[model samples]
Target chain A: EPEVTQTPSHQVTQMGQEVILRCVPISNHLYFYWYRQILGQKVEFLVSFYNNEISEKSEIFDDQFSVERPDGSNFTLKIRSTKLEDSAMYFCASKFNTNTGELFFGEGSRLTVL
Target chain B: AQRVTQPEKLLSVFKGAPVELKCNYSYSGSPELFWYVQYSRQRLQLLLRHISRESIKGFTADLNKGETSFHLKKPFAQEEDSAMYYCALSGQGLTGGGNKLTFGTGTQLKVEL
Candidate 1:
């Protein structure tokens, strides 16, 4: 079975530094998303991308965050000036269609900000 | 605002016992509900969706619109069922914004021997 793949399984960064998490979604998937989960917290939606543009975003996805489908297979999330609170597990997910509403998630990338 | 609530943080049951993972959501419009599971050291994956109305791994969840719940139920649970389960909701339709999932805090199910 094809699955979404994410890079940098674990990343440690200093405060005020920049970090970029990459993901390669399933080849045929049309919709992609980025979500994060703080330790012991629920998974929170950050942003969704389709057609090479952002479709929607949550308050957590503020000016510090940006997502790009730099290529046909690569989707990335960049956080500028990371803060201590930004430490969390970021997940990349993709969906084949709207009818099923089933999403395939990648093994999250753990980001640690000191 | 769409929110998913899984009241139980941890649930333990013996093998062969029945299991129920409670899930509730708050949404004004029609919502698409799903149950995702993550086994030990495994990536989060979809377990079932309300639209399918079909059971997977002998687990079934009925979407109770009246109570805004989609609780997962499984009779005679096996030890392999031990995992973390999350209930999620989506507010998007066929022609609207992207498919953004709002997930619950998740329930850790431990099927003991």
Candidate 2:
């Protein structure tokens, strides 16, 4: 079965440095989302992308955060300057349609900021 | 704002015992709720949803609006049921904008022999 795939399963970056996490959602899926789970915290929604633009974002997804579907297949989340609090495991998920309400999730990329 | 609360951080039970993972949500509008499970080293997978109202893997959950809860329950827990379970809600409707999910802190269930 087709699944969402993420690159750089783990990334270590320094504070004030830029970081980018990449994801390739299921080919036929339309809606994509980025969620992050801080160590021992609940999974928090960052942003949701559909039809080429972000539809909604959480407060955590502030000025430093950006998302793009640069190509038909790749969805990426970039943080301009990493902070110690930014260390978390980010998961990418996709849905085939709006009605199903089931999201297929990727393995997740663990980002560590020091 | 939408928020999900999973009261228990961890739950331990013996094999063949009944299991219930508590989940509660605070949402103003009609809620769309779901249960997701993550096994050791595996990606999060949908276990069931309130909309479907169907049982999967011998587990079931009923949405109780009056109680503002959607708890996952299994009659006889198997050892393989050990996993982390999360309850989520999408307060927004499906059509207009991105349906971002608000998830609860997961409950780690350990089913031992």
Candidate 3:
């Protein structure tokens, strides 16, 4: 089965540095999403994207966060000026349609900010 | 605000024992509930959705609106059933196509031999 794929399985960056987490959703899937889980915390939704634009975002997705579908196959999340609290495993997910609640998830990209 | 709660951080059971992973939600609107599973080194996958009212891999969950809970259960556990289970909730606001999921802290199930 086709699945979502994330790059840089793990990344370590210094505080105040820019970090880009990349994902390639299923080819036919239209909607994409970004979620992150701080160690020992629940997975939190960051942003959702569709039609090449952001559909919704949570408070955690502040000015420091941005998402883009730079191409037909790539969806990327950029975090500017990383912080210690930003260390978490970020997941990318996608689903073919909203009518079906099944969303495919990637293995996740672990980000560690020092 | 929508919230999902999986009380137990870990639930360990022997193979063939009945298993239950509890999940509760706090959502004002009518919500969609789902159970997702993640085995070691694997991606998260949908296990059950309350709307479907079906069982997958011998796992089942029912949405109790009155209790605001959607707990996952299985009749007999197998070693392979061990995994990290997450209960998630989404608001009924399905606009153009982004149903944001709010997940619980998750319950780790270990089906031991």
Give the runs in model 3 whose Cα sits over 4 Å from its true position: none
- Residue range with the least summed lDDT across 10 consecutive positions in model 2 chain B: B90-99
The DockQ values of the predictions, listed in order, are 0.67, 0.66, 0.76
Worst 10 residues of 1 chain B by lDDT: B91-100
Give candidates' CA RMSD values in order. Answer: 1.2, 1.2, 1.2
Backbone collisions counted per model: 0, 0, 0
Whose lDDT is greatest here?
Answer: 2
Tell me the deviation in Å of residue B66 in model 3. Answer: 1.5
Which residue ranges in model 1 land beyond 4 Å of their true spot?
B93-96
What is candidate 1's DockQ?
0.67
Taking chain B only, the TM-score of every model is 0.96, 0.96, 0.96
Per-residue C-alpha lDDT of model 2 across residues A86-114, encoded as one tens digit per residue: 99999999997775558899999999999
What does the lDDT come to for candidate 2?
0.94
Candidate 2 residues lying further than 4 Å off, grouped into runs, are B93-95
TM-score of each: 0.97, 0.97, 0.96
Q: What's the true lDDT of residue A40 in model 1?
A: 92
Please provide, for model 1 over B1-113, each residue's C-alpha lDDT reduced to its tens digit, 9 standing for 90 to 100: 89999999999999999999999999998899999999998999999999999999999999999999999999998999999999999886335556678899999999999
Q: What is the clash count of model 1?
A: 0
